[model samples]
Target: MRRMRTWCERFLRKRSSRAWFLTESNRIACVKRMGLEAAGAMSRSPSAKRHTSSVSLKILVDMDGVLCDFEAYLLEQFRSKFPDEPFIPVSERNTFYAHEQYGSIKVELKRNITDIMSSPGFFASLRPISNAVTCMHWMRDIPDVSVWICTSPINKYRNCVSEKYQWVEKHLGFEWTKRVIMCKDKTLIKGDYLIDDRPMIHGEEQFKPNFGKHVVFTQPYNCNVTTEWRLSLWPERKDKLLDFIMFLREGLAFRD
Candidate 1:
C-alpha cells in the first residue's frame, strides 16, 4: 500500500507539470497572435465581442449587389450618356451585356467614378438598391450576429477603399469598425452565408465545405451564376431580403 501511494503521487506530479507547461505555451501563442510585440497593440477583443463584430457573422454581405446597387448606378450613367440607346432601368437590364453595345458606357462610368468618388455628391448619386439599406439596418439589430461587407475593388480603383467607407457612412448612417473587406479571397474569412453577385467567387458545388450557402444577387452582367437562389432586387422579390435577415436573426437567436 505504501509503494502504490508513492507511485500515484509521482504520476500526478508529472501530469500536473505537463498540464501547466501546455497552458503557458498556449498563453504565449495567443499573445503573439494578438500582436503583443507591436507597439500600442491592445489585447485581442474577447471571443464574444469578435463574434458580434462586423467581421464575424452568421450572414456576410457582398458590397456591390447585396448592399450597394452598383449595377443600378452604372445603368443610370449609361442612360444619361446614351439617352437614345434604349437603355433600360437597372432592374430591367438583362445579362446579355456585350462590349460592342456597352463598351463606351463602361468607359464613361470608369472615368466618372474616378472623378466623383472624392466629391461631396458621390453618395447622392450612389443610389443603393431599394431595400438593401433597410435589410442591413434590420440585420444590425440581431443579437451576436455579424454583417461584414466583402468586396473586390479593382486594383486600378484604389480610391474605392476610402470611397467605400464614405459610401457606408453616408448610406448606413454609421461607421463600421472592421466590417469592410476588399479582397478576392473572401472564403478565407469565416462566414455562415455569403450574399454576393459572383457565383465563381465561392467555389464548386459538390466540393463545398461546411462554410454556408452562397446567395447570388442577379445583375445584367452576372446572370450565368451556377447557384439557384438569385435575386434581381429584394424589393422586386417581395421582401426576400427581409426574409433572409429574419431567418438569420432567428437562427442566431436560438443558438447555444
Candidate 2:
C-alpha cells in the first residue's frame, strides 16, 4: 500500500506540472482575448474567468493504437497459435473484432475477440509504430505541454496493467513510466486533448466532445471517425503533431 501511495504522489506531481504549463498557455490566450485594458489591468469580467476555467490543457496520448502497432502484434500471435489456419493479411484487419475477420476463413482457428491479451508478454511485446518514439520526445520537449499516456487496461488480464508499464519503460524509455496512466475509463479523465483511435459513441449516437479537443489517432478500426486531426502513418504523423502543437502555441498569441 505504501508503494501505491508513493506512485500516486509522483503521478500527481508530474501531471500537475504539465497542467500548470497548459493553464499558462490558456492564460496567454485569455490575455489576448481581453486586449481591453482598463487601468493597466484587463477588466475583471465573468467571461474571462469562465474561459480560463474551461480549458485544462493536458495532452492525453493513447498506447495501443497511437504509439504501438497492437493489431499487427495480435495477428502475429494468431498465426503462431494456429499455424494450420490461413494467415489473415494485415490489410484485412479493418475492425476491432479479430475473430470476425480471421475466424474460420479456411481452417478455423476460432480465437475469441479478446484472446492472448492476458497471455504473458503480450502488452510488453507490441512493436512501436514508426516515428512514435521521435514524436513522443518532441511532444515532451514542447513548452509547458504535459504529455501523458492514458491507456485502457484489459480487466481480465491483471498482467496487462504491469506489462504496459514495463513496455513503456522498455521502448519509450524510463521517463515515460512516470507519465503512463493505466485506465479503462478515459471519459473520467480531464484533459485539453486526447489522441486516441477509440470511437466516441454513446449507444447509437455520437459521444459529445466534453473531452476538450478530440484528436482522433487513425487506425483501421477508427478510420470511420471524422475529424480534422485524423493522423495517418508515421513521419507524416510526427510532422503533423509538431505542426499542430506549434499552431496552437502561436495561434493563441493572436486569437481573439
Candidate 3:
C-alpha cells in the first residue's frame, strides 16, 4: 500500500496524471493498467463483485390473478347468491374493489365477501386458471430457476392463510406447499420477477418495487395500467413467462 501511495505521489508531478486522478473512474482504470496486483487488491475490497455461477435466478408468482382465479371465483359466488341482481359483466368493471357497483345491496355483498374470505374452503375451492397448472409444472423442473408461489392473504381473516396452503397442496401438489410465502408487502421480498395483476400494489409513491421486472397479469381491474408485458390469456402468457426466464438465464450465463 505504501509503495502504491509513493508511486501515486510521483505521478502527481505529471500534469496529465494529476488531471486523470481527479476523476475517480479514470484513476481506477490507470491503477489496473499499472499492474494486476494493485487491481487484485482493489477487487478484493467492498466494491468487489460477489455474484457467483452457483447463484440461481428466482421467479416469484402471485397466487390470485396469476394462477388461481380468485376474482372469478368470488364473482361466481356473488352471482349465485343474488340471482335477481341486475347483471354487470366483469368487463364493465374498472377495478377489482368495485363493490360500489352492487348498489343499495352492498352491505349484504360486503358481509358475504368477508364471510367467504374467512371461510376454510373459499381459497381451496378456487379453480386453477387455464394453462396455469401446466406452466407451473414446467417451471418446477426448469434449470437454474427457483420458483415460489408468493401470495398475500387477507390478514384480517384468520382462515385466509391456511386456506391458501390447502389450495396450493391440493392443486399444485404437496411439493409446492413448501414455497408459499404470505406477506402483504411484496417489496420486502427480493426476486428476479414478480408476475401479478396489480402493478403499483398500494401506491407507486408509497410502496415502490424493491427490485426486478414486474409482469402485470391481465385483469379487468388492472386494464388501465398500460405496459408492454400485459398478458391477457393463459397459453400466450405461459410462453411469454418461459421466454422471459430464458432471457434472464442467458444474461446470467454470459460475461464481458
Candidate 1 displacement at residue 251 in angstroms: 9.0
Error of 1 at 178 (Å): 3.3
The TM-score between candidate 2 and the true structure equals 0.67
* TM-score of every prediction relative to native: 0.55, 0.67, 0.67
Question: Least accurate stretch of 10 residues (summed lDDT) in model 1?
Answer: 38-47
lDDT (10s digit) by residue, model 2, range 84-104 = 657667766665656666554
Question: Which lDDT tens digits does candidate 1 get at residues 1-256?
Answer: 3433343244235432212112333233333433222201212222223234343346777776667766667666656655765554565544433233343556554455444333444434566777788767766765666677877664446566667777877788765626777765666656777777765564333256333756667666567555444455554332334334433432221110
**Residue 192 of candidate 2: its Cα lDDT?**
66
Clashing pairs in 3: none
Residues 1-256, candidate 3, lDDT per residue (tens digit)?
4555444455444423112123344344434434554334333431121222233778788988789987778778767866765545667766655455554345566666566556667788899998888788777766667888888887565777888898888888998899987787787777876778775665232355653666677878777876544456454344444534443442321100
The list of candidate 1 runs beyond 4 A from truth reads: 1-57, 81-101, 104-124, 202-211, 222-226, 235-256
Give candidate 2 regions above 4 Å deviation.
Answer: 1-56, 99-113, 201-210, 236-240, 248-256
Pairs with steric clashes in candidate 2: none
* lDDT of every predicted structure (CA atoms): 0.52, 0.62, 0.63
Global local distance difference test of model 3: 0.63
Candidate 3 lDDT trough over 10 residues, lowest sum: 45-54
For model 2, the run of ten residues with the poorest summed lDDT: 38-47
For model 3, the stretches where C-alpha displacement exceeds 4 angstroms are 1-55, 98-108, 203-208, 236-241, 248-256
